[model samples]
Target chain A: MTDPDTDRHNAKMAKKKAARDKIMATKTDEKGLVIVHTGKGKGKSSSAFGMIFRCIAHDMPCAVVQFIKGGMGTGERDLIIKNFSDLCDFHTMGEGFTWETQDKSRDIEMAQAAWAKAKELIADPVNRMVLLDEINIAIRYDYVDVAEVVTFLRDHKPPMTHVVLTGRNAREELIELADLVTEMELVKHPFRSGVKAQAGVEF
Target chain B: MTDPDTDRHNAKMAKKKAARDKIMATKTDEKGLVIVHTGKGKGKSSSAFGMIFRCIAHDMPCAVVQFIKGGMGTGERDLIIKNFSDLCDFHTMGEGFTWETQDKSRDIEMAQAAWAKAKELIADPVNRMVLLDEINIAIRYDYVDVAEVVTFLRDHKPPMTHVVLTGRNAREELIELADLVTEMELVKHPFRSGVKAQAGVEF
Candidate 1:
């Protein structure tokens, strides 16, 4: 008893759904993923943290290693520390941005320490997702060897663990190795107009 | 006495923090923000959801009206429905993608209903953050009038409320009006390689 438009819509949706099912049928592979988020826009790390939140919702274990952003307080870190501490291994190991530190050797040392922790988390099969927050920045600065990182991921990573690397200037090697890579392009930012970062939105 | 490297790092950071503090001092205005997330890459809606999580952490009330993504089960929707129902007003008011539905009149009706709900949320001062999820797509398809949407936002949005719009092909008008805009460019995606969208990652 449906009208012509409703009948037509239903028929069209049925056809589309069938085609989608056929496409879905071919995607049978299940394994870990290497996800990379990079570029000058704001959401690279925020989006990674979003995934961590999603993992938390599903009760999946997660580990986070922040390479160059630990010198100051961030809302996401504080929230994780306060509520989801049991499900998350959160480490903010950096002394701050490289420019702020202004010490190449010290920055390299911190990056190495963070990488050590990242390797440990990746090697452990218990953790479902390991977020290498800002690790790309470290790699971009040559604090961590890109080839070594790739080799470790290929040789040592668990089969079902997801690893997310985020920051600006991600290496070509990492991008090539990643299963998903997103570049957050800066279209417009309030900061350029003298608006400062605010809580509950920026951090 | 600390090591020379440590001392130098501390001095540099002190100077940098001071400069940052100076910049922070000038930022006195606080008001609502119109934020837009657009482009071909993923994480536009995911990043907006991340902010919703942040708001939940801060005990802020939020309202989300999804324009074109409610034909099936999504992990994020389920998670919020299960846990954070008290803090968020969640609405999924679309039949599916435009191609799937293939009915302009029905799509317009759904878009109008969603926009009505969006206006209600945006006008309510109790809602600190109102996310108009995928409204850009609705506007792109001309199911809703862009001018009307912009006028409503400009005239009715509460001063302290934040409104976020997520979807591809954001209108130039919205971009011009937004305080923060991010274009997520796709660098690589596993879907192109036959990897299906898995739960907890894509949803």
Candidate 2:
């Protein structure tokens, strides 16, 4: 009772399913990965935070250390602090952005302290994921040495810890070392049209 | 006890703060945003979910209509169903990918149905945010008319309901209509190196 179109469609789908199965069979290697989110567009930090929420849903321990945002009251940060303090070790270690701080020596000191906490979190086997939010900006400003950060990640990170480093202008060394890297290219932004950042979205 | 560096830093920060305050004074307009996330990389859907999590934190009602993933048991979907069900209305409308479905008529029917649900959510003032997940793919394939979608979005959507569309190869017309658009460019992918997607990250 099947029509000719239905038969053709079924045949095509079966072939595709078979091909996908073949590809899936070949992908068996399993290990923790270094993921990098960068570029001029948005979602670099938001996506990392999404992964953190996923970890929370799965009951996996995770840590987040903000490098440049300081202690500013972001919706994501506040939510985590209020509901997920037990599951997440969240830290805001900077006074503010570089332009606001306007002190190179102090910026470098703050970056070093944040990096120390990040390193400790990466070494902990109990933590399933670690997000070094905005570390790329610190690296770009030369406040934190990218080579040292890369070396520590390579040598000290636990086998099962997925480390996510996010910010614009990620260093080539870190990108080369990462297993996954996505550059969020800016296509269009409303701020150019005089729209300010708003709550529940921008925060 | 104040050193020259501290005094210099203080003066510079004060000037920067004043400049920021001036800029902040001008940004007062508030409205819903048309957000598009597209290109050949990850985090498009993840970041949208992050926004949804932010909405949940704010006790803002949201809706998600997944167009291409079908009824896959993703961790994000499960978490929303289990814990955030009261806050988020989630729907998976597609049978699968086009290749997996291999039925043009059926795909078109499913896309239309999903669009109807999306429109309902967008028009409702109660929904602060509505995610048309993977709608770009449906538009790219012509399964759903892009012009009608854009027209309805412009004319019928509530003023305060932020509409987020996610998928690869977003239509230029949609981009032109969007207030925010991000192109996620793939820098590197673990799947290329034979690493499979893992739980609590890929899901």
**TM-score of decoy 2:** 0.91
lDDT of 2 by residue, B70-154 (tens): 4222667777887788989999998888878777778889999999999988898999999999999889988889999899989
Span of 10 residues, lowest total lDDT, candidate 2 chain A? A68-77
What would the TM-scores of all predictions be? 0.88, 0.91
Write model 1 residue lDDT over A1-203, tens digit each, in one string: 56887777667867887898788898877778999989998788777887887787788999899897842127667778887899999998898887676676788899999999999999999999999998988898788999999999988999899999998889999888899999999998777777766666875
Chain B alone, candidate 2, TM-score of 0.93
Model 2 global lDDT (CA atoms, 0 to 1): 0.86
User: What lDDT tens digits, residue by residue, belong to model 2 across residues A133-193?
Assistant: 9999999978899999989889988877899999999999999999999999999988788
Provide i-RMS per model in Å: 3.3, 2.5
Report the C-alpha lDDT of model 1 over B25-45, residue by residue, as the tens digit.
887777778999999997898
Deviation in angstroms for B144 in model 1?
1.8
In candidate 1, list every pair of residues with a backbone clash. Answer: none
lDDT against the true structure, each candidate: 0.84, 0.86
Off by over 4 Å in 2: A1-11, A70-73, B1-24, B70-73
In DockQ terms, which candidate is top?
A: 2
